[model samples]
Target chain A: MWLYFLKRLGLAVAVVAIVIAALFAMIHAIPGDPARVALGPRASEELVAAFRERIGLDQPILVQMGNFYVSLLRGDLGRDAVSGEPVLRILLSQLPDTLYLVLGSILVAVVPGVFLGTLAARHRGSLIDRVTSVISVSVMSIPAFVIAIYLLLIFSIELQWFPAIGAGEGVLDRLHRLVLPSLALGLAWIGYVARILRASILEEMNEPHVRTARAFGLSENRIMYDYVLRIAILPTITVLGIGVGHMLSGAVFAEIVFARPGIGKLVFDAIISRNYPVVTGAVLLTTIFFVLVNLLADLVIAWLDPRVRHDLAG
Target chain B: MTRNTALSIRDLSISYDTPEGRLRAIREVSFDVARGGITGLVGESGCGKSTLMSAILGLLDGAAIVESGEIWLGETDLLTLSRGEMRRLLGDRIGAVFQDPMRSLNPVLTIGRQMTDIQFRHRLSRRTKRERAIEMLHKVRIPDPAARLDRYPHELSGGMRQRVAIAMALMAEPDLLVADEPTTALDATLEMRTIELLRELQQEIGCAIVFITHHLGVVSELCDDTVIMYAGEVVEAGPTRALFEAPRHPYTDLLFACDPARIRERSRHLPTIPGTVPGLIDVPPGCVFAERCPERFAPCGRLHPRPLRVRGSEAVRCHLHDPEVTS
Candidate 1:
């Protein structure tokens, strides 16, 4: 197990390295001069040239990439081109809010989603199943921004339940402000997670072990929760891990709608200002996080079923 | 004749509702197991043997409905028990071991965990449960039983797993143990070993066992009484030795004659009962075996044969066995 963990970690590092390299290449490939964008359209050509040199844009792409790589190894993500703030510092400041929103959204999605899915699965072919299936499917089919806007209009503008814009301060205030955005982001995912879980659980419910459990006189609750859920949750974990990547992207729409400060908003603003360092830094961080989550999911599944672990070993 | 009945099923008829029509899975099947006796229920696949087991266990499929029946476990009619009462009775008063040890146990749980969970409803202490689990494993002759506590079902070989299943079924020391073809998936040697183990355990535990199988050898070797089913009906039943000596029903007679072990010389082609077991929806109203019964007469197609006592403690569902001699 230790060897497997180490091997996975090593492979993750290699993947992240390639991702970072690709992000660098892709960002540079876009037709734009960061220095020129930072300088106004009315700025003089000489000032622009000096600005380019000051930011090391005058160097060759290969040299710049090597310097960037070295500095990244040293834990420096460079300065934002327009704002001149350290990209890493800006990201660090934004990281907590994003983490809170993402984690909260995940909680929002998984709890009720799993509950509804379980309910639907248990009462399969009944009215409850049909209703939940329709509701979840509808939620999934609609766009995230549309859901966010509706939430804003109903909760903020009409009901006066929450503030519509910006991430608020302090622990309690931050959570209070996150409610709308989390719901907006999570509602759609709830439907997806619920659907997958319902399918997985229904399949597991039919397994021969379930009959064995029943023959042992285990209650339906024990059978469903203790036995069936353990097997069914494997696929759900994989989906939820993949959901992390989706959450990050969805947070962009959520942040944009709420005008909140997080990685999503950070990336959005950086792109508008042509802040290459901040954009590249945020994307790479998200990618690394995504890879780690998927790895965690794999480990979890292997832990659940020894057969899978044996397969992995061989 | 005065032997105590452990589990007696009477007038049990089960049918499955489908889009096409209602299919009778088991048709007024009646049988009884003597206390501490192994009663063999044997038939070809799809002859309602499994359905009978499920009905006894109260684990029938969603589509199935018990049209009429009483499954008497001692004084209690099992079909009349509430769901909770039934749940309490299962694994406490009645335990089960199924075929295919590979699929019978929860793959994700350790053997110890699965056994402990079975004991949990009794509210035994964790330590006591663990000890009981190890003790049961030992009874099944699993070597290093204590160490095997942490192993998953798949980690054990097929024979070892089946033994574990048997051990689990015997763990609660129930009055009845329903084993549904428990050795069908095993090799011949392993099958015999398992049957021996089961017989020994039966002696030690003294639970009435409903041993379902298609193996006549198993019936002869392990069962005290044998019930032969053909197309969801009990065609013949008697003491194992008596029935084998002289089968009254033609199907039973044909089944015995077709036994490969009974063949003196190796033949290129083996004898088989011609025609298939009829589909549940297509079963003829008269004798279910009439289509394939070589001894069928004019009256065979027109009337369902009732049980007729052929001799002491032996009966056959055939017109030929009738005292009036309708055939």
Candidate 2:
């Protein structure tokens, strides 16, 4: 099992490597020179050239990437062009706010989502099932930003239940401030999770093993939770990895609407000011987060399902 | 009901609501599973063998409707019990080993966990349950039974998996053990071994078995009594040897003839019964087997023959054998 875990972790590290390369390539491939943008259009050619040489923009893209990799190994993500502050330092400070939002959203999405899915699956054709179905569809149809703005208008501005701007200080305050943003970001995936899980449970209900479980004279509740859900939840774990991506993108909308200080807001500001190092650092961190969570999800799946453990071990 | 009667199905008619209209899956079928006897329920595919098995277990599909029936386990009718009561009785009173061993046990669970989990009604301690699981596994002749408990279903070979499934089913030592073609998926040699294992286990446990299969060779050797079902009806049912020697119903006779083992001549093609099974959606207003029956005589196409007593403890459902029978 440990060997299998190491193999999966190795695969995840490789994926993160590819993602870093892609991120670097895409940013560099964009129109306009980074050197000119950093130095400003009014800077003389001599000064711009000197600046470019200083940042190693004068070298080939491969050399620049190689230099970046070496710097990454040294725990340096370079410095912000304007503020002259370390990019990794900036990201680390700003990351916790976003982590709170992401983790909280996942909690909001999964707990109720699984409960609703199990309920709907149990009462398959009932009024409650139909209601949840319609609601889930509507939630999926609406954009995360729109939901964020509406939540801001209702909860933050009108009701004054939560602070409308900036991530709050301390754990309790931060959690309180993040609740709305987390809900907005997580609402769409709740629908995805519930619908997929419900379908999965419904399908698993007919599997031969489930029938055998029933014939074992297990109570419906026991059979469902122990046998059926154990099988049904595998696919949902995979979707959760992809849902992290959705929430990351949705974080942009959520942080902006709620006016919270997070990696999303930090990246947005860095992008606007052309703070390339901070942007690269934040993107790299985000990619790592995505890869790490997926790897964790895979490990959890392996632990839950022995068949997968054998397949991976092989 | 006799105390020896482990399970008794009486005048059970089951139908399914299909797009093509109500498909009559089973029609007025009846049988008894005597305690300590292995009863073979053999029939073609879609001939209501599975339907009857499901009904006996009280785990019928949502689409199926029980038009009329009573599945009596001792004095209590299984059909009359509520879901909770049935749930309580299933693993304790009416244990089942399904057709496919590979699909019978929960794949994610260890063999021990699945075995012990079925003993919910016993209220035993955790260690006691685990001990019982290992003991049952030993009874099924699984090697190193204590070590096998930690392994999942996929870890075992097909034969071993079937043994695990059987061991799990009988963990509670249920009064009736339903083996639904338990050895069909095995090779001939493995099938024989499984049959032997089942017979020995049944003798030790003294539980009635409703073993469903199409393999006549296996049934003849394993079952104490045999039931031949055709088109959702019992065409012939009696002592295993008696039916094999002299089948009273024409359907049973034809079915016996189709057995490849009975082929005496050196022929290119193996024996196969001509004509397909009748569609259950629109059953003919006559005998269910009339269209394909070799003895399709006068009134055969228009009259549905009622089940009649024939030889000692044997019953037949065909117009040809009827001395005085009614629809």
Which DockQ value does candidate 2 get?
A: 0.82
**Over the stretch A1-314, how does candidate 2's per-residue lDDT look in tens digits?**
77877877888778877877887788777778767887788999998898777666788877878888889989899988777789888999988888888998898889888988998999999999998898788888998888888888999889999887778878788778888988998988888889999999999888899989899878888889899899899999999988998888778778888888889999898777667788889999998898888888888898899999888767
| Model 2 lDDT at residue B293 | 81
Q: After best superposition, candidate 1 residue B170: deviation in angstroms? A: 1.2
Once fitted onto the true fold, the runs of candidate 1 whose alpha carbons sit more than 4 angstroms away are A59-63, B1-3, B323-327
TM-score of each: 0.96, 0.96
DockQ of each: 0.78, 0.82
Chain B TM-score, candidates in order: 0.97, 0.97
| Residue B198 CA displacement from its true place in model 2, Å | 1.5
**Per-residue lDDT for B85-175 in model 1, tens only?**
9999899889999988999899988999999999867677988999999999998999999999999998999999999999999988889
Q: List candidate 2 stretches off by more than 4 Å.
A: A1-10, A29-47, B324-327
Candidate with best DockQ: 2
